[model samples]
Target: MSDKLAILGGKPVRDEFLPYGKQCIDEEDIESVVKVLKGDYLTTGPNVREFEEKVAQYVGAKYAVAVSNGTAALHAACFAAGIQEGDEVITTPITFAASANCVLYQGAKPVFADIDPKTYNIDVKDIERKITDKTKAIIPVDFTGQAVDLDKIMELADRYNLTVIEDAAHALGTEYKGKKIGSIAHMTEFSFHPVKHITTGEGGIVTTNDEELYKKLSLFRTHGITRDKELLVNKEQGSWYYEQLDLGYNYRITDIQCALGTSQLEKIQKFIDRRRELVRKYNEQLSDIDGVITPYEEVYSNSSWHLYIIQLELEKFKAGRKEIFEALKAENIGVNVHYVPVYYHPYYQKLGYKKGLCPNAEKLYECMITLPLFPKMNDRDLDDVVKAVNKVLSYYRK
Candidate 1:
């Protein structure tokens, strides 16, 4: 590797460009999808139920409802929580817009909360401060795959009589206090996007121990329709009778996608292990480097390592995050930022959300950078990343 910075016209770190995240699809995964193709039913079939059961069992939850995507999962969870106009939901601003947009979808408002500076999870104290009588729910995101302070959030929910809808999109394999994230919250949501721990092609699911919530989520996944006789108003109808009891959307996940989900679920443990191993190497290589702050892990939680975000100590660096980001990209390092504060977007601004709402989260947004991480990456790939980061940061250090 070259000792000089690539942005300064020196030799680049690698001959090929590396991506920040990607799916690991193998022949077994292909075979699973092919089997689904040969089956009689392609959607709303046995594979969907089997994948849901596998996910629920893997996370120690009693029930799971599969949906079209993570956004749909959040929308379904919001519907199940009964959030509506004039209702408020508390959530951290340091997450994907969908974390808050789901609230908007239900004609409700999303109150912005700050984040824990170290772990980057939602701040419980801020969540409490943002709550009020109008606050009907809390959607705490497990940012960067670290579990939020579930114990504290659950306690607050109890104190305020608020529903807890955990956004576990980045935390499929994460655990809090030895309990899996999905099993701990009132309603936990998981995404199976290509970059996630597993891929359902484009799908999501919600898991809950409450049967009532399970029913509501299931109804919401479909068009609020039900065929069970016990819950139906007309008990005398024939076997073909089904009714649309409540207003819902078409958010069903296909049997084809579920087949891929079931196959991918089989290797979650292996995927998580490799991610943890890569993170350890990142910590070792980057820990001693100046002006770079490695991610912090709380003793009570084991993160799934969905993203490896590093914060730049701006005071120690001569350049800001954008210049540094470009420098690394010039070295063939695929660096990305996990999020921009949700309120900072123009759409939120037009919705009357202001900047400086969550100071800590805003500060973190200015310094954070997501580095390349996935199960398929090897030691040399990790080394190349370290070398590029060191080279860029060293050249820009004040």
Candidate 2:
């Protein structure tokens, strides 16, 4: 191992910090938000419907329901799918907690499934093995924006008479076998957080082709209230009348955020293109480096590249993940870990989940590091990230 330290003698790659992921906003995004600020309605208004329509058309889905945030979107989908007490939903453990927590929101059990180690996605066979009589749904997450094997998952869902709700928060522009992700699944959820492909400050939406599911999602998003005359039990109650059909939450998003989302959606293709370009550059630069393993992309799908993750060969390094992570941070590179297996969390453990549930996911979590990848990043930013990673690894190599 090298004796020199960047903190002591060598110059850092960058003077400023570079975050793992960030939103790209411009004049148009600002202008759109300003327009909404001056509009008639800020909460549930025309902009929300227009944004939903634009997203539906973009993803080739028939209907879209905008919600407060990604977690809300997942909860709405689970509720719409009729996930109740005693139901089991199989999903990958190598994802954000919200992916599994949504199942718990409906008083359903979330069954942890191991991931395909190479692709870092839920294993299809593992999903099949986890299914039982109580299984009512499968919530396959598109980890790091790579689309899950929807065909296989859907086949399993069909065989078991189960609903498939895709947690596609990381994948907005991703395509699988020449088809958009949102259009393929029974119901798909998207996030518009600052780190996601698009931003509405903090917002999410659920997309689907099923009309009944769409209706349920809409109702659930707004406290289960309905104003449509056709759906009302009491006819001729007057135009001012509304009714609460079922128990639901107020997961509604404001038009101000939706306006921003609509603007960001217009540039989504460009954003995705830039992210892909950066991933390609990172792959080319780091693939042959010792003790480093770049992300793997399956042939059947094109990833939106939400987060570019690298797996470290810990056996070949004297330093552990925490040391390397700190080294990168010392060089002004903002790196992160995508997740800690959902079942490993204290709350999940309290709910009867344990550490050994998904070995592959736990193993992956031990070695993986999320690097910076955003549309706003230039060649210099990419170079700095690559340089910092190389410096850390070389100094720590055994």
Candidate 3:
């Protein structure tokens, strides 16, 4: 313990501070970026298409559209799904703002669904209660890498004729009932941020099998322009001629990012395997701690373990979650809260949403703490995290 503590200031236990999540770079990743940098096209090129095709194949979808980021992917998905003003999209409150903001982008209202207390994903039962004639879709977030109960959500979607666009930012490598996550939903969105299962610096993809939807997404990604001479209502009769089919933003991803993404995709399995191993170790080490509740995985789900979130057992803690969090930070273990209920934000609150709308999400928000878990962390780092957590728990546990 003394030597480990000395390593902290002597040089820093990590080459840099251990972030909760980060990109895993390797020799192949570097070479791929260099190749793209030296290539002819930088953006809207063949590599973009190749990356899309590879992702589509990997996720078992018919088409994949690369975009600037996950937010852009969600925006395109919402637009293609036909979300409009007065239309409502129900989604979990325990996700990044993009999950709900995408609906707002299309001028649709975002309805919040409370999460399952056990799985911390959207509660299907609660989602059913929020549905109405104006409800057009449900964006179920695969929170923290655990696959949402797509079967239940799909059943509801089938009953209501609502589209299902999965917010799979945290679930790039997750599986549900033996099927890959993107394949199980009508439309699936993936993120390639540094913290995600893979990295492209900042990139995302939309995957779907519906040809019409795929066409819409394709055009929506690049200023609504279509190179397809066939879709032109009036052709210039030249190969270079193209047309803007509708109002769309320039959400195209660069070749450099795609190159990195494609390279990162190759090591996705390794990243996921390592993350899963770390999660297992955390679960085992924290299970017996009186004030900590480890993450839960559904029997039918195989998670990518993008984040390892734990809930504080309020009954067992004397100082509450905030105090415990600060204590861990003081010990040099980076800890963070996953989210504040989306409705609790000022933007949503302005829209007539309130604190009590999703009680489960609010309750979870109070106790949720995201631990540092990444492929770069070694056993010593793991021990530091576990020990820090234990030290905090012992100090606060009643």
Off by over 4 Å in 1: 1-4
Shift in Å, residue 267, candidate 2: 0.6
Each prediction's whole-model lDDT (CA): 0.94, 0.93, 0.88
Model 1 over residues 135-206: C-alpha lDDT tens digits?
Answer: 999999999899988899999999999999999999998999998889888999999999999999999999
Error of 2 at 138 (Å): 0.1
lDDT of 3 by residue, 210-315 (tens): 9999999989988998879779977776787888999999999999999888888888898889999999999899898887889989999999988999998888
- Number of the top candidate by lDDT? 1
TM-score on alpha carbons, each prediction: 0.98, 0.98, 0.95
How far residue 280's Cα lies from its native spot in candidate 3, in Å, is 0.8
Evaluated at residue 22, the lDDT of candidate 2 is 85
Per-residue alpha-carbon lDDT of candidate 2 for residues 124-233, written as tens digits (9 for 90 to 100): 99999999999999999999999999999999999999999999999999999989899889999999999999999999999999999999999998899999887898
Candidate 2: residue pairs that collide: none
